[model samples]
Target chain A: EDKVVQSPLSLVVHEGDTVTLNCSYEVTNFRSLLWYKQEKKAPTFLFMLTSSGIEKKSGRLSSILDKKELSSILNITATQTGDSAIYLCAVEVLFGFGNEKLTFGTGTRLTIIP
Target chain B: EPEVTQTPSHQVTQMGQEVILRCVPISNHLYFYWYRQILGQKVEFLVSFYNNEISEKSEIFDDQFSVERPDGSNFTLKIRSTKLEDSAMYFCASSEAGGLAGMETQYFGPGTRLLVL
Candidate 1:
């Protein structure tokens, strides 16, 4: 079965701390890896990584894909209390007839303390 | 920024009852999708729709599930018969393109929580 596993299912960090969340997947016909920040109800778009080694960065968040190892990492620097939420990693793969689907991981719940 | 929107943030129903989840995808999006996440479980793909027809569906999308784009902007998912196991948070998503190999970003809606008793 296609699988996406996230490590350290839960993490607690203090403000100003830096943390890394890991995700690894084993699936057929990999297309891209996406990261999302799920706060109350929606899983807000974060970054989508398709190339290996080259990193995608936002204001304080960044992610990189490692196709060689079938893994990805999300890094959040200088975390704040508002960063407390479930970080999700979803792998997009091609389906039959040119369709696409996103296989999501259980997600890493991060709690940032002030 | 355009965002997908869903109705009935929460719903309560009895087993075997029918339920219809409503969604309004971003106006310019051409593709639509439905996903569900049971409590404490990972979000799962249910179906994808494009051009008023289903493009792809996962194994979980059985005979009990159906989708339709009644109007130009509204997409709907209907459950013929709800089951206790079917209670979950359903999310609607949309993308400007098919997200095939070109990598189109899919924007998701705030999900609707359903409970089957």
Candidate 2:
């Protein structure tokens, strides 16, 4: 079965501090990796990593995938109270030629204190 | 900027009662999915639908659960008999399937919180 694991299940940091969340996975057919931010209801997309050693970035947040290590890391720089939320990592797998599904990690809860 | 939309931001029902959650996926998307997250638990996939039929479903999607795209636009999930365990935040998502390989992103709805009491 495809599995995804995230480290540092919970983290607390003061405003303006930087934090990194980690995720690793094991899957039969690797397709892509996606990151999401969840505050209350549904999760919102953050970034999708398909190639190794490539970094994808958005304002105040960036993520890189290391295929060789079967892992990815999300970095939040100059964090603010608004950045406090659950970070989720999901691995998209193509079981066969066209079959696909996403296996998600438990997620890391981040709290930024002001 | 289109998004998936779900109805009944919150629903309260009793055990053994039937309930249906509705979703209106992105107007142009071809694939739809249903996921649920129990409080303090990771979100889980329940069912995936495409071309008006169910393409895949998880073990959690038993005989008590069913999905239908009854019309051209709305997608629905029906639970015949609700259990306490069925209480969770249910989300609906859509993606533009049949597109370039690995190029699609599944956009999610705000979700409907279901409470069974």
Candidate 3:
């Protein structure tokens, strides 16, 4: 079955610390990988990576896809209390005719204490 | 910036009762999708709609599930008969062009939490 797995299921770190979350997937027709942050409700988009070795960054959050290893990583630097949330990784697979679906990991619960 | 929107932040219904979840995607997006997260479980894809027809669906999207774009501005997911297992946070998403060639990203809604008892 197509699947996504995230490591370090949960983490706790002091504010200003840097953290890294991991995600790996085994699937067919992989098109891209995306990261999202979920606080109280739905997830907010973070980064979407398609090319290996190329990193996508926004503010303190950055992500990279290693297609050769079928894995990706998300890095949050200078974390703040507001950064505490469940970070999700999802793999987008294509089904022709511009159709697609996202297979998501259980997500890494990040707790940033101030 | 335009974002997807869903109605009824919360809903509680008896088992076997039908429920409809509503969404309004970005005006320019052409592809719409439905996803759900069961409490601590990962977010799961339920179905994807385009041109008013289902383009793809997961195994979990069974006979009890249906989708429609009732009007030009709204997309809906209907569960014919709710089961206890159906209680979950259902999220609505839309994308400009399914992001081929890394062109666009799927925009997610705030989600509607459904409870069936």
Q: Work out the TM-score per prediction.
A: 0.97, 0.96, 0.98
- Number of the top candidate by DockQ? 3
Ranking 1 against 2 by TM-score, winner: 1
Task: Specify the highest-TM-score model's number.
Answer: 3
Model 1 DockQ, alpha carbons vs. true complex: 0.72
Q: Per-candidate DockQ versus the true complex?
A: 0.72, 0.56, 0.75
- Return the lDDT, model 3, position A5: 99
lDDT of each: 0.93, 0.90, 0.93
Ranking of all candidate structures by their TM-score, best first: 3, 1, 2
- Please give the ranking of all candidate structures by DockQ, highest first, separated by commas: 3, 1, 2
- In model 3, which regions exceed 4 Å deviation? B99-102
Worst-scoring 10-residue span by lDDT in model 3 chain B: B98-107
Better model by DockQ, 1 or 3? 3
lDDT of 1 at B114: 95
| Candidate 1 displacement at residue B90 in angstroms | 0.2
Error of 1 at A51 (Å): 0.9
